[model samples]
Target: MAVNVFASATEAGDTAVPLGGSGVAATVDCPDLSERLTTVPEQARPDVDTELARLDEQIAAAYRQLQEAARTADDAKLDEGAILDPLKKERAGTIERIAAVIGKAGKRPEGLDTLAECTLRRTEVATTDAPGGSPDQQRQQQNGKGEEPGNTGNTGNTGDDGDDGQTGDGQQPGNGGQAGNGPVAADYADINSVRPNVVQAPRQKNASTGSFATSCGVNAEGLFNSDNLIAAPGVSNGAHHFHDYVGNQANDAFSSDEDLAAAGTSCADQGDKSSYYWPVLRLQNGTVEQDAESPGGGIEGNAGEIVTPAEVTLRFEGNERGEVTEMPRLLRIITGDAKAFVNGDTNANASWSCTGFEDRQLKDKYPLCPSGSDVVRTFTFQSCWDGRNIDSANHRTHVAFAAADGTCPDGFRAIPRLVQRVVYDVDAPSLQDGGRTVPLFAVDSFPEQLHKPVTDHSDFINVFDEDLMREMADCINSGRECGPDTPPGSEPGQGENPQEQPTENPTKDPQEQPTENPDASDPPAERTATASAPAVPGQDGRDDGESEGKGGGSGAGRNDGQASAPPAQERDDDASPRAEPRAATTPADDTPDDASGAAPAPGATQGTGGGEDAAAGSATEPQATRGGLAETGSGLGLWPAAAGGVLFAGGCVLLIRSRRRSM
Candidate 1:
C-alpha cells in the first residue's frame, strides 16, 4: 500500500501540517528506529559458567548489602540515596569485575567484540547462565519488592509462540497481508484517540513498486567505543555505558559537522554521511547485578537505559524510485519512545519491520525471509510534527503516526518520507546448534520483564541539501519519479543511470541470516504507509478511535495493544515464494571481499578485565573488583552470601514501606 506522499502537498502551503507552521522543518539532522534479528556467530564461544557464577554471587551479595543499608536508613530515618549510594557504587565495582573476566577470556563470539556486544550476549544468556538465572530467584526478588509498574504475568511474554495468537514466533510474520508485528507495547488509548485532532491531507500518489529503485545503504560491520563520544560532552569516552555508532566510519561522540563532512562513510551512497548511534545495551555477566533494580534504575533488568540491538540499518526510498535523493540538511527526528523503558508502554508508531526475503514487504516481524534476502531493519519516522516542539517530554507528544489512509495531519506539512532500513548480516535460520534452530534476534528489552522485545525504537537526523529536500518533497508531493540522476527539472527517463541496484544479498553480513522455511510469492505488504506514520507521545499503537481504558494499568494494560497482535491469522502456507529462498552461498563466517571487519573496531571497547579488579581493564569505568569470578570460591568464601541473607530480610522490610508510600 504505497501512501499518498503529498496529501494535498501544494494546497498545504506554508503553515500547513506537512510544511510545519512556516513551511520549514526543524534544522537539526537525526533519525528514529525499529528492529528484526540475525544470529551472532557461535565460534570460539567460551563457556562463562565460572565467570557468570562469580558475577552472580557478587551481585546477590551486593544487593544484600544494599538492602541492609536501606533498612538501616529507614530505621534511622535517613535518606535512602545516602544509604544506597555506597551499595550502588559497590554494585558497579562488581560489574567491572565481570568485565575483566570477559576481557581476558577472549572466547566470545567474534563479531560481538565490544562490551556492549558482550553485554547483549550476556543478557540473552543470563536466563541460562547464573544461579540467579532461575525464575524462582526472579520471583523471590519481586516478592521482596512487592510488585513494579508492569510486573504482572510478563504480559507479552506469552511464551514466544502464544504471545500473538497467529502461531509461532510471537505473532504471524504477515497476517492478513499485513507484513508487520511491530513491538506490541501497552495500551495507549489515551494518546492515540484524541491528541492529533489534526486531520490528514493526501500526499501519497506514486504507484511504483520501487523494483528498479536503487538500493543505497550503510552496513555497521561492528560497534565502536571511544573517549571522543560527542553525545556525552565533558564526560570521558562516552557514558558509563558505551554507544553504538554507524555511517561515518570515523565518527565518535566528538565528531563535528566538519569532521563528518570530511570523514568517510560506510554508506554505498557517500552523499548520505549522517552519523547514527544510541546507547549500547550491555548483557550483564554473572559477575555483577544482572537483574533489573526496583527504584534503583529506570526499568527492570536495567543493564543499561536501552537494549543493544543486533544491528542498525539505514536507507532512503520515496517517489523517485528510479534514482537516489540527497537527504535534506541536518533534519533530525527520533522515532519510538526512548522513555518506554521508564513508561512501560510501547509506542505504536515504532514501525517494526523485517527484511531478507523478497516479495514479502519489509515490515513483517520475525518473517522467515527467503535465502539471499537482505535482513533489513527499517524504521519509519513521524512526519507530522506539532511544529512547536522539537521533542516532547515523553519523546512522543511532538509527533504522530500518519492516518491509515495516507493523509498528512492538518497541522503537519508534507515532507518526503525518509525510511532508514538497517541491514544485519545474519544468515537464514540455522538448523544446527542443538536442534534448537538458532533463535532470531529482535529489539532488545528487559528479558522476562513485562516490556517485551516488541518495544522497538529508533532515532534519525536528516543531513541533506535543503534544496535537495525541497526537490525530493516536490517529487513525492507531485508524484514524480525523480532520482539523483534525475532532479525535478530534468526530463523524464533522461537522468544519470545509476549503477545496477545491489541485488538483495544476505550473505555479505557475517551474522546475517534468513528464514528457515519461507512462505513464497508473498507480495510486498500493504502497511508500508507506516513510512510516514505520526510518532507522538501516548500514541501507543492503538487505533485512533479506541475507547479509553480497555485495560489500563501496569504491564498488562500496556500489552493491550499487543493483545490485538496475537489474534491475527497466520499467512497461508500454500502460497509459495515468487523466487525460492536459496541456500547460503557462503560459509556462515565468510567475510566479504569489500567487507569491512578488521581488528577491534575503533571507539569500541574490547573486554580485558578478568575475574579481578578491572581498574586497569578498559576505558569505560574505574571500579574495584570483589570476590573475582568464581563459583563459591574458597578465597571469597560464603561471607558475602551469608551477609546477603541478612540484607534480604531488611530489604523486605524497606520495600514494604516503600510500596506503602507509592500506594
Candidate 2:
C-alpha cells in the first residue's frame, strides 16, 4: 500500500473512501456505559465488580495518553505515520481490554444507565512546525481518529468503531457483568457464556459420515508457497506473517484460473487440491534478539525463521450417521478474528490442548502438555453453505455448521467441515532454539506481536475445479472415507508404530500420481495445471477482500457439533505415558543457509516487503529483529506521511460536515 501523493494534494473533493483506508489502523471504541453502572450499588456487585471499576479508570487514562500522543504527532508533523501508528494501536488495545472486562462484568441493573460509550473525539493541530520544512513546503498534516474498536454490541472500539458490546442478550442486562471488550478481559465463565451468536443457523441434516481427507505432509521440509489457487481477485500470499501450508501443492494467493483448472492435488485423492494455510508459529527465546521478543530478540536483528515442525498430519473427520447429497465444490474459510490479541475473547475461536491432556481441553490460557505430549493448536472453520452463494457478504453468512446429528439448519445446507490441527513437537525442550516452552500463548503467539499477543488467526482459498469440488462434496455427503491410502486414525501401512514419521509422500495421491512442485521450480504451465471453472470466493481479510460485517469478511473459525467440552472436561491419559520419537527440528543458524529449506511460506516473500529472506526460511538466515515486517521493508515508519494526509483530510471533512449541519 503506497501513499497517493497526487490524489491527496490535487483532488478537488475528499474521497468517499478514506485516503488511507488500506493503510493505517482501525478504531475499535464502543459507547461508554459508566453511568449505566450507577444502578447496581457498588456494594451489591460481585468481587469482580471492583476490578471492572478499576479497569474503567485505566481506560480513561489510556484515552488521555492517546490524546496527548496525538498532540505530539501533530506538533512535529512527521512525514511517515509509522512511529505514532504503533503507539496509537497499543493505546487503543489497552482501552478495549478494559472495555471487554467491563462488559463481561455482567449486565448492569435493569435500568442502570452508564455514560454513553466514550468517544475518542478527533483532534488536529496545524501544520505548525514540521521538521526540515519551510512554511509552504509542509505538505503533511496529522489527523486523529482516536481509538475505535471493532463492532461488539455496545462495547467500546479497539482502533475503529467498536462492535456493539452487548452479549448474546445484546445488552448489559443490569450491571450483571463487566462491560468493556474481548474474552481475554473476562474470565472463563464469561467466555463460554458469550459464545458469539452464529448468525447463520445450522442447516438440518438427515445422515452423516461421508468425507475424504488428504494425508498431512509430515515432512516439514516440503513446506513452501506457490500461487495456484484463487487468482485474479485476491493478492497471493498477502499475510504479513509467514504461513505453513498443508494441502494442494500448487495453491496460493496468485494462482490463476487455468492453474485451478488442472486437477492436480496433494490430498490422498488425486484431484482434491484445496489450499490451507496459517501463520508459521516461531519459537521465542527470552535469550537472543529475534528469538527473544519482537522489538527485543533475534541475533542479527531478530532470529532466523526457526526449524520446521517434526511432523504434520491432515485428515478429515466425518459426521457419524451417513453421507448426504453433495458438498460445496470449492469452499474457503479463515478461522478467528484479526484482533483477538488486543480485544481478547472477541473471537475466541481457538483451542489449545496437549495430546494426553484432555482434562484441560478448553482452558482460556494455553495449558502445558504433559512431559511426552505434543502441543496441538486446533482451528476449525465453518462449513455449512447457504447452498446458493459460494461466499457470503461476511465470508460466513453463507456458511453455518451442521448439527451433532450432521444436519444443516433451516436456510443452510451442510458442507463438509474443515478442521486443522497444527502440532508442535516441543515437549523435549531444546535450549539451542528460542527458550519457548511448548503451549505458549497463541493468537499473537509472537511474544511482542505487531498488534496484540495471542492474536492467532488463519486463512484459506479453495482453487478446486468444479468437477473435483463436486466430487469432494459427493464424497462428503456420501460418507465415503475419500482417501484411499491414509484415512483418519489409520496411518496406512505404519501399523501402530505411532512414533516413526509416516513415509507416505504427500505430493502424490494414493495412486502415486506425480505432483507439481510447490516451490515454483517446475515450469508454469505444468506446475500450475489450470482448468476453466468458476473461481471460489476469497476468504477473510488476510488478503484484500470486502467488508467483514453482514455475511461477508470471515467469521470466527467455527463451531463443532457443539462447543468442545470446557477445560474441566473429564479425561485421563495413560497412567504413565510411553516416550515418543523426538523430531529433529532444524535450529536457527547464524549463517544464511540460502540453499536449505522450502520456498518461503505465503506472504513471506520478496515484493510483499522482503519478507521471504533465506534467513526467514532456509532453516537459517539472519535473525530478523522485526520479523516479516522489516523483511518486507514495511514498518510503521512509512505510515506517518500517509497517516498525516488521511487524518488531516478526515478531520477537515468532519469539521466541514459539522459546520454545514449547524448552518
Candidate 3:
C-alpha cells in the first residue's frame, strides 16, 4: 500500500487529470465512538482502548480506498459496494466487540451499531493564494473603496502553469510532490496580512505568574513512531501519522507505565521525563523519506522530506486565576484535534503563525512567511485537572480548560500549563507553479484529514517525580522563573544566566546533551545564555557552528535551498516558551456535560469546560473542597445550609490565617 511518493496524477474518469490541482474531494466521516464511551469499567479499559483504535484503523482503510476511486466515480455504487458498505460491516463487528467487553464489567453500551454507517463528506478546495492587505483594506475593497493588494492577485493559480507533468528525464517534478492529496495553494496565507487577534487572558490578583522552561533539544535524536501510547495503547500504527518525540524516549503503542517511569529523557533536566510529541512536518519536495514505505508515511498518503524543527521550546506557565497544583505523574493529555477536519473543530487547539508574527494566529490556514521569517507552530495545552482520575474512559474528562475569565471549573484544579512552540526554516512554496518551483510543506496527518493545518495537534504525558513536581509548583507559586539550565531548586534570578554560575552533574553522560556546536563539549544545561530574537539567525543561543541541521537519516544533506531553523529567541508573550494568559475566543468550553456519568451521544460535543464554579466559599480553598460543599448544601434545608455555609466560610478563613502565619 506504499504510495508512489512522486505520484504525478490520479485517474479522474475518462480524462487523465494532471497533478496538483484543486477541486472538491470526498472524505469518510464517521461517528467518534470514543467520545461516547464515558464510563467504561476499569477492568475493560485495555480491551476497550484497543477496540476504539480499531475503529480508527477501519476508517483510515476506507479513506485510502476513496482515494483510489476517481472523482467521476458513481457515489451510489461506491457507497453500497466498494467503500461505505464494507466499512460499515467492519465497524459493526468492532462495535460489537467493544460492547461485549463492557458488558462483562457493567451495563453494556447500547445502540453503538447504529454508528457503523458512515458517509462521504465533500471538502471544499482550499485557496492557495497568499492573501494580503489589512482587515481595513479588505473591508474597503469589498465596498469598492480601494484596490486589492498585489499579493492578493493570482490566488486562483491552479498550480498547473505551463510545466509538463513529466520532466526532461521522464521523472515527475519533485517526485510527484503534493501527491494531489492536499495543501493546495489556498491553504497558505501571508502572515503580514493577518490582523492581530491575540488577546492575553486577564490575570487576577492571585494568578501564578512564574514560568519554567524545559530545554529538550528540538528532537535531535529523531525518535518517531505512529503509535499513540495514550490514545491507542497496544495498537500498532494507531495514529497513522508519525510523531517526533522529544522528552521521554521509551514510548510506543505497547509501552507500559512502568517502562516510562524507568526510561531516560532528552530533556536537559533528567527529572522531567514528560513526553512531548506532535506530528512531523514534511517538505512536499519529491525527495522520498525513509518512512515512505511505512504505515505512517507514503502508505498513509504522507509523503516527502521530513523537516526537523530549528527551535523547540517546552515551557510550563502558571494559572491566571490562582496557584497551580502539581500534575499527577502519568496524567495523560491531548490538545488539539488530530481529526479536526472531519471532527468539526470542536477540539482544535493548535495555532499556526510565523516566527516574528506570532501575534497573528491562524487556526486553519498555514502561513507563507517572508523569506527570512520561518513558519511557527504553537500548541497551548489544557491547564485544569480533575482532582481524581489520571485518565478517564474518554481520555478527555479528567482535564478541562479554564473559563474565559481564567478560573478553573468548580471541581477542577489549575495546574501548570504547557505551551509548546516549534519553528521550521523553509522557503515559501511557489503557488503559481503548484509547488514545482519550491515544494509545499505540511504536517503529517491521517489520510482522510488531507494534511489540513487545522488538524495539527500535540500530546503530553506528565512524568515528573514528586520532588521535581513540588519544586515546579513552588517556583510558580512564589513568582520565580526557572528553566532546565537553571540550578536545581534555585531561587528567582539566581540561575537566570547559566553562563555566570553553571550547574554540572558529574555522573551524567556527555552524549546526553545535544548542542548545535559539534566541537563544544558542554551540554545544553550548561549554556543558559540568552538567545537573540527569533528573527535573527543562530537564535538558538548557539554560535553559527552550532546552528547546523538537526535532522538525521533521509532528512540530512537535503538543505540545498532549504533554510535552517533560526535558533532560540528570548522568552516573550508571543515568541518565548512562556504562554500568554490570553482569553480564548474560540468557544472551546461550550460543550455540555453528559448526564449521570453517561457518555454523550455520538457526534455531540464533549464537555471541555471546568465544571460549574464551586459553591461560594473561601477563595483560597481547594476547588474540589468548595465543589463538594456546594453539592452538599443543595440537599439541606435552607436555614441549616445557610448556617453551615457561614460556619464553613469562617472555618476556612481561620485555617488559611493559621497556615499563612505558620509559613
Candidate 4:
C-alpha cells in the first residue's frame, strides 16, 4: 500500500506534467473571466452566465481526458494539441458568445480572448517525511518563515511524520482511490504537534456583542445534489461534486429566487428559508454509493461511501467593532476557495481540526484525530456587505472581510457573521494502508482538484423573513446572547428556555425537546422557535412538518397543523448514527475562556482601543440591507457542539471566489 509522497514543491511544479504514483497527471488552470467584467448588462446576464458555465465545462472535459490518458498510458504526455488547444478553441468561442450577448445590451467587453488560453498545473504538495526533505525545511515553509520555489502562499505544515508502513490492503498509500488525485499521506497532520496560532480580536466599545444560534437539523434526510445555482445557474451538474444541503429543500441548478422563497426548509424554524450547503465527505472504503456511477461521483473520480455528519451548528456572531445591520434577503456568500490546490491560498479559508483540539485550526490539511475524538470543520463566513450589489460580476466584490482592527472597509456594513461548525464521528484511517482497514474520508471536490484538503469550501444564502432578520440584528447589536428558541431580548436559560447546559447528543438540541402529549403522525410543537416567531406557509399552502423534508427526527412536536405524510424515500445506506463523545476540557493554561458564555458587552470598557465610552454613530446600511434593489441569492454545511463561548476572530477578511473558474 506504500505510495510515493511528493518530495518537494519543485518536483511537482517543475513542468506541465507531474509524476504521480501512477504516472503523469495534469490539470487545467485558467483565469477567471467573470472578474474582469465591471458590469453585466441586466438583460444579457442570463445568456452571459450560461456561456461562462460553458467555459467551465470545456475545462472539465479536458481534465477528464487527461485523467483517462494517465490511467491507461504509461508516461503519457499532456500535449497542448490534444487537450489545451481544443479547450482553448472551445473557450474562445464561448468568450465571443459572451461578448456578443453583452454587446447587444451594453458596451462590449474587451481582451476576453486573452483569458481563453489555459495552462497545465500539477498538485503542489511539500513533504518533510519524503526522501529529499528535512523537518526543519518543511517547518520553515509551513510557518511562513520561508517559501519553496513555485509554492508561494502555501503556509500549511503537514505536521510531524506518523506511522508510515505498507498496509495489507492493495490501495496505494498516497492515492486515496483516485489515481493521481489525493488525500495523500502528506495531506494530514497530528493536532497536538501543531502550534496554537489562533488570535482573538478584542471587542471595541461600540461593537455588537449579541449572539444568535439557529437549530438547523443535521442533514439526516439525505438531501444531496451536484448543482450550484449561484456559481453556475441553469447548468445541471454545475458543481462536479456532491453537496449536503440544509435549510432550503428546492435548491437546484434551475431554482429561481421566487422558487426558493416559496420552498420548504429543513431548519426547525420554518421562517428561515435560507440555504446552506457544502461538499459531502466520503469514506474511501470501496463501498459504492447510489451516486457512484452518476455524474459528480465515480464517473468524475468521486468514489466511496458518503459520510453524514453527527451534528451541525449554525451560529451568528456580531462584529467586533460596531453595531450590525440586517442582511438582505437573497444575499449570496461563499466562504472558502474550492479550487485552492491549483489556485493558491489567497482565498483558501478551510479550518479543519479534531473535536477535542478546537484551538488548533488547519487551513490546508485535514486533522487525523485521535481515537474517541471526532473530526470537525468550521466555516466563518464574511461579515461585511458592500453598499451596492447583492452579487457582483465575480460574486465576491459585493462583500469583504473587516480590517484587522475590527472595522469594516468604508462603504461596507457589518452584518451578522455566520459560523458553521460540522462534526463527524469516524475512526482514524490507517494512512499506511491507504485507508484500507478504517476507510480514509475526504470532502467531495471537482475531479481536477484531486480531493486536496485545501480545496474544501462552503456556500450560503440569506432568506430570513424581515421580522426575524430584524430580531437577529437587534440581538447582535444589543449584545444579548439568543438562540432560535429564545425570545427577542432574552438570553439562553432565561424565560421559557428548555435546556440550560450543553446536550449529550450533538444532533438533537436540548432545546428541541418534544411536547409531552404528541400525536403519532404530527410533527413536534415548538420545534425551535419561541412564541414571538410564527411558522410561514411553504409551497402549495402546506406547512413544513418535521418529517416533510427530513429523514428522521424524534417525531418532535411543533405548534402547527398536520400536513400530508412525508413522501417515501430510499434509505441512505451510508448514514448510520454514531456516538458523539464529549470533548475534553480546554487546558487551563490556554487563553482565558470567557465564562459568561456571551461576548463582551457592547458598551463595556474599551479593549485595545483603550478609551472611555464615546458617541456611537448610526450603523451603515448597505444596499444589500433589507428593501433594496432585490435580486436573487443561492444556497448551502455543519456538524454540532457544546454550549459555550466560541469566540471566532471575525476581523479577518474572507473574500472567496465562486467555483466558476473565478480566481
- Give the alpha carbon lDDT tens digit for every residue of 39-138 in model 2: 3323333323333333333343343334234334423222223323443454455445434444565543332123223222121111112111110111
lDDT of each: 0.29, 0.32, 0.59, 0.55
Candidate 1, 188: how far from true, in Å?
23
lDDT of 3 by residue, 298-361 (tens): 8888888888887676667676568899999999999878887877655776777664444345
Give candidate 1 misplaced runs (Cα > 4 Å): 1-217, 220-244, 249-252, 255-263, 278-328, 339-342, 346-348, 351-376, 386-398, 425-452, 478-663
Candidate whose lDDT is highest: 3
RMSD in order of candidates: 30.5, 30.3, 19.8, 21.5
Question: For every model shown, what is its TM-score relative to the native structure?
Answer: 0.38, 0.41, 0.68, 0.67
The TM-score, computed over Cα atoms with residue i paired to residue i, of candidate 3 is 0.68
Number of the candidate with higher lDDT, 1 or 4? 4
Predictions ranked by TM-score, top down? 3, 4, 2, 1
> Residue 313 of model 4: what lDDT?
65
lDDT of 3 at 121: 55
